[model samples]
Target: MKAGRFEQAQRQHIATLVRLGEGREALAGREIIQRSWRRCVDDYRLDPSRPRPVRVLTHEALVDSREPVDELLYVARAGVDQLFAQVAPMGYVLLLTDRHGVTVDFRGHPDQDAALRRAGLYLGADWDERHAGTCAVGTCIHEARALTCHQREHFDATHIALTCTAAPIHDPQGRPIAVLDISALQSPRGLESQSFGLPLVTLYARMIEDAYFLHRYRDTTILRFDTTRAFVHFNGRGLLAFDPQGRVLAANGEGRALIDAHAQRTPPAPTQVTQLFEAELDDLLALPRCEPDQLRALRLRASGEIRFAALVEPRGVRSRQRDAAATDAVTDIATGATTASHDPVATTSTPDLDRLAGDDPAMQRLLGLARRLCRQPLNVLIRGETGTGKEVLARALHASGDRAEGPFIAVNCAAIPESLIESELFGYLPGAFTGGNPKGMRGLIPQADGGTLFLDEIGDMPLTLQSRLLRVLAEQEVMPLGAERPVKVALRVVTATHRDLAALIAEGRFREDLYYRLNGAELVLPPLRERADRRYLIQRLFAALAAEQDGAVQLRADALHALLDAPWPGNVRQLKSALAFALATREGETVTVHDLPESCRAGLVSAPPLASTSATSEAARVRRESDDALADPEGLALARTLAQASWNVSQVARQLGISRPTLYRRMRRHGLIPPNRREALRG
Candidate 1:
């Protein structure tokens, strides 16, 4: 129908319903739209004929407001891209909004960018009920569910021309973090015309939600199940992660349904693994992964209903069974320090740097330097691999500094969109641009005043903004996008990146002056493979994690050996990921070689079939290294003699006709940890 005809029909219909005291049921819209219409008429007092213009945040303000949802934006990137690819062909535009109903991320045809922006469908658009009344984003957020607000259903006259379908993307804790919306400037008026919109938006929303849940609970045991075996592995819907004691950590919508059904409740209450399953926790842990035959016998505790189950294990920690006595020990494993029995995990205000690196001279030296510089306002540059704990070091620096009382603001330069990065770091004035907010907003840089601004992945920053950042670093003040004057800020700047800025400078991609400004004090972190204190650090990391999980995690000797031998190309980050995977999958309290990830286990597997070029070469290198160890007959004989003598250094040194230091040096060269240290840790 034409706009003029549609408007006449809608107004007449609403007027007739209002006269009959049934304005809500008079339309084909859902209850959500009816409620919104009532609110528009009653509370907001909006005129049906007079529609308000859409409100948008100034670019700088938008960036600052979106910082909390930046990770969600990053996580939604792939899903949004896939969603757009599926719907853009049909003239649909997708907008992802923060919980406040502000469009933080948008995907649409470039040719329609101007039209979309003009229609308030672009980034920085705020679709909250007060802003964009009765629309999909606003109504979905208010309703906290999926729904379609078709044309003529919208309370705002301006938006009645658009059809929007929206679904809420929830966090692991079940709170809506953002809304995924698909809207069209023009679409058929019939309700059946956009029937596919709801399912499409909900499907992608679930996908994004599942991605978030998996990432958040990678260290926990994930139980995935469905009526059919095939869907268990492929579908993200029926998924749940549990703690060691079987407490529910997280669950997807489908898994929640299964859980609710088992409990015989409309909405499931808090549940534990023991409460839901007939089998013992130990038996469940021992169950094979993704095996249809094994899953056939699995039954729910409440109704004895059969379901297929697949377990996803954490890859990082080695799993081993604890003896009755060890299991009953009072020591806290999570923090690697003894605490009262009230809680297994203890919270700390300060970073536990000691547990992060155990007795490594290089790390200790860096920590000492960092501590000294923390008292001073130095711009520290931490250079390390992506997973090498650069941010942790930055946090440590913040906690150690005098500015620890102030807020610690962190910005991932690479995670933010190019057009918005500046405004995110700086503030903006009201009316700075088209569709901007009536009231001005403060940026992140000013928000970090009297605190610390940790700029992560700074190397990814564009050269265009380098000069602006340099000015901030030198003058300690920020100029808002359209402000006439600069505001002074007293804060320390710390930056970290995996990329080499010197190389970037050589390519003319990074500013040399900016590099020098941020490089006031440089701390280089060593990769996990090169660190000599691997055994202690590994134990510490697992112990801390075990405590946090409210359980005990131990490493079998073989598992420990595999961890020590694996070339961790991704450094500490990779190691943590592997450990988390192993912990989730391990059958018992102790992680064995079989419990580790395939990449980590491959090195431990003797004469295993080559799967890839890298695996083949790694096997060959291992064999050659083992041959070299075998070739050292004297060293092997000495080691055997030491083992026989119960690792008595003096006895072994005397038996081998060498000085004690020489024996120690030889043991170190052969990659042998001192038996005393190993035994003490094992105990």
Candidate 2:
């Protein structure tokens, strides 16, 4: 019988008992047959067509099979021994089988083993339907499901001494793969023994299936859920639900939180999907389904919460063929949603400014200036040390500004060859050079029309091209090499340079006029050393990198401190390299200080420590005294001003003159805060 059909048959049998008013009496037979069927299927991989026969196979004939019978026998014998040694009080016989439906492996206690073998129930026996009709392993295999049998339920009269439970193991793709069975000699206690072991056998089968699936479908999304709707799956974005018709059904914890606060206040009742998004859904579904690139915001009816969602239908002839081959392969689950339009001022045209990572006041100031400049079409000059993220800041400005909808074409001036710089920048006509394309090319400036053009390493731009670049900026037109006509270009230029352009101009290496043109609104980025939050950078880098490595590694406390104290000459780039190297060499959970590269290790050891114990103790005392004296408002203001001026007596005197002495007296009178002259302060 087929597995599905067997289940149907069992259900029918149970219904008949209930209808006959013998439901309670039928339980015994039901349990017995279920256990016996499962055991026969699991033990011999059999089917109903070839059920166990009336006569049992002799031990010698069973052992004579050349098929992988010895391995099965060994495991069965071992299992039986273990059952007797540990579960002897329970008293159960272990049964095993080969890939085929044959009882190649079996075991029992020494006393029971001898008696069972003599009774034609021991090793080398074939319990398949061919030999014993409607048996455990054989029938279950045929049904491709679990089964059980109870005492007196044997197909053959010679098999009256046993009861069994069995289950079939499936491969990752749900094919009936293997069988496991357990049997016990008949006892006066009835079918309870087989019933008790049914779930255990079933659980083992499930474990094997799970492992197989995990391996086979490694790329597919896997979801795990707890009783109360918590997500326990790995690499999951969020919990989501979809109706049979593919409508948004529900969302997980984090998704619900993202809805507008007002929307969350009046959420829909349980099992109710918000109707507010009906119009939006209709519009989305109405749009041409040919291309799925366009995504729109979905707003909830009850809570006014909004989410971004896109529909993706399989594309291409190949995809259709694959879909036909595996109709059930694709799951129509709602993948996830991100917050939509949270800030009215922020738009798609606005560059993703917030992507830049830093908390320094200088960086904040630069960002503020970038935001303001984004609204106007003005040239921007980004000045910073190499690897200090100048280009990142420039991209942010473009993304946050009004022209964000325009293209962002970035060209590294230093990387391009000097000879090709002009052609590359201004483009060329067909056959403009020896190997140039016959068709004229659009220059970078023309290509960047109606968008932002980022010129990185602008300082390295050859002096000859500087004048031509200035002309383009001045005229808003680019004349391609060998092209007769000048192309009118509208572009916003954002240039970055590590070298001091003003210094270069003074040295006659850069054009003075071009420098002024590119420096329309200069934003200088401070180096990592100037940022006080080195500790924050270390922690962020470590956490971000560790997440990328999955569970491969982590950094120890000492290693993190070493990272913080070391002067990052290469800034973030150097830090990332060191972390990556350390993680690669790490043997266990944590990366020790010694795991760092030789350069980083040397830098950490060579650097002067932040503050010695004695210095910290003294500084602490000074802070206490300062805090005590600044209790009064007037005294506090004066103390702050003095501290701001670094407590320089001459500068203090110049600001507060004859009153300086008197202010000094007053400060003493008010317990003036003393300054620590040891540490230098940057203005």
Candidate 3:
């Protein structure tokens, strides 16, 4: 600005402060600013005539000041970047300040860095009300609300040329923890020029606050609701955290404001869920299972307003049939060991620990060991080949334990990129650079608090991170990247891999110490072909698959025999997929030998040799019955012909003296499918 114009603006700012101080009026601007200006002169004993230079901390002091706000910076970056993208084009710079009013995170035009620094809008700048006088962040911190400090509203003469709007970011307890501000070095003279600024700042501030709230309390039960049912799941405006027994623990700003304004004047304003909503704790918990795919309806006790609500069950708070099984397992553990030895096939069967196997002696013994191991928090190493259901076993182990109610986060070490795995597994320092996923610091390791961390394919994890994993296991704490301090976490670790770690260690590819740390107890899973109880397992699996189908399908004797003869190289996963395919393709209500997928067998599907004169006579009898004059009255005759030929379209088409396409067309006309195989390809 020109010297003469700058002097004139400073004189105008001082005159406005003097008029507001003497009149004690709300007319100058907003009541919030009027209050801040009064406090600046009377409470802080600051002279409006004197202009204070912007206070920017030295490099070392800036680093020290940033440490405590690191986590907030990490969680708020996404929302900040998103809002900055929208407003940066409008000549505004976004600043996120710590609760103490020091700028910790910043985004602005790189070309104008020097001007922003000189104006004290850069990182490490302090904007405390006592230091920077009445400014957006400083005044917002003191008022604990949102306001626009445009031009002459600023108490400092040096700042009369700038316009800044800011909102307070409060924690779950309603304490202002940070401030979000957007400022421009120059703006239009009227306050209406900043009409868009305060509202957008307030909206994103709430978003950032809610995101950090969820991140901080991710392991706990959170109840979110909205006045409209349609928006409950996607944009619930209220967030409340409660214990398993329905006792209110903490609430976000929206929740607190709603409760305080609408709840009953008496009865201490709801210390329990039943107080706020007219429903018992059990009824509320049941809502999740009652409408697992839909938002539940809740009525407020104060206003009877219907709320569409969603409950996030962080643990197994709701009762399930699995709970009955878990109770049995816990009881067994209390009494005695459930046969963790090879000779005892006579151990007690538990719903928690005994359901994975079906009469295999080796598996029975291993499950017995698993039952004993799960009774306490112990690290376990599961060794099995690919597709051998290692993850399922890991889940079963987690379910059987006391920690079953807690989270079970499964991480496939091989799937995540090496650059990202470190941050994802162990978290990273606040403001740390992450290339792959911008929000990588919302890491998996910290989320496993009070739960299980299942590391699948552990053999593929990078060597450098292995040491950090070992340290976390040993000390029960993890140090994030560039972090000066460690965070405490309680978790049960389970590692599984098909690769032999012993061999890897011999080749120096795996850590010996980490191996021992992971292997407090080791369990091996037998391949499907090697299990003595294969027949029983197959029957059990087929029955379960049948239950899931629209119509129950019968497993014919020949189908069972064929399944028994096949080499199940893919183990249980493959077996289940094959059975499911059979159910999907079965022609009638029965699963026949030919209904199974061709890929399930080692070689291509081929028809067996013709039985004898008896079978031939029967085929001829069926064909004779279906003469061209009277086309098999019921389509059953056509179905019979197809079945006799092992459902092979080529073989059946030859017997009928028709091309495969014609046969397929006739079959489609009769609604008699040949187990999904296109007979035309056989020709």
Off by over 4 Å in 2: 1-352, 551-553, 602-683
Candidate 2 local lDDT, residue 8: 61
Model 2 earns a TM-score of 0.39
Error of 2 at 415 (Å): 1.5
lDDT of 2 at 71: 24
Error of 3 at 372 (Å): 41
* Global fold similarity of model 3 (TM-score): 0.48
lDDT of 1: 0.72
User: Cα RMSD (Å) between model 1 and the true structure?
Assistant: 19.1
1 or 3: which has the higher lDDT?
A: 3
* lDDT-best of 1 and 2: 1
Q: What would the TM-scores of all predictions be?
A: 0.53, 0.39, 0.48
Tens-place lDDT digits, model 1, residues 1-683? 68688678667645643542344444443667777777766776666656677898998888776777755665566788899999999999999999989998888888988878777998899999865778899989888889998877777766767889999998887788999999998886676899999999999999999887776675678887777666766672577888888888878787777777876643365477767767788877776665445453478777777777777775334222221133333222212211122211112122334335656778866665665477667899999987788877887777666687776777888887888788778868998766556686778789888888888899999888999999988888899989999999998999999998999999999999999889999999988777888887677656655554456667899988888888877676556555654554355578787555545654544455554676455444433332233234444445445655767889878987999999887865543344455333223
Mark the regions of model 1 whose C-alpha exceeds 4 Å error after superposition: 1-25, 262-270, 290-297, 315-683
Query: Per-residue lDDT of 175-231 in model 2, one digit per residue for the tens?
Result: 555566766665556666456678876754554444443333322322222222122
Best by lDDT: 3
Sorted by TM-score (best first), the order is 1, 3, 2
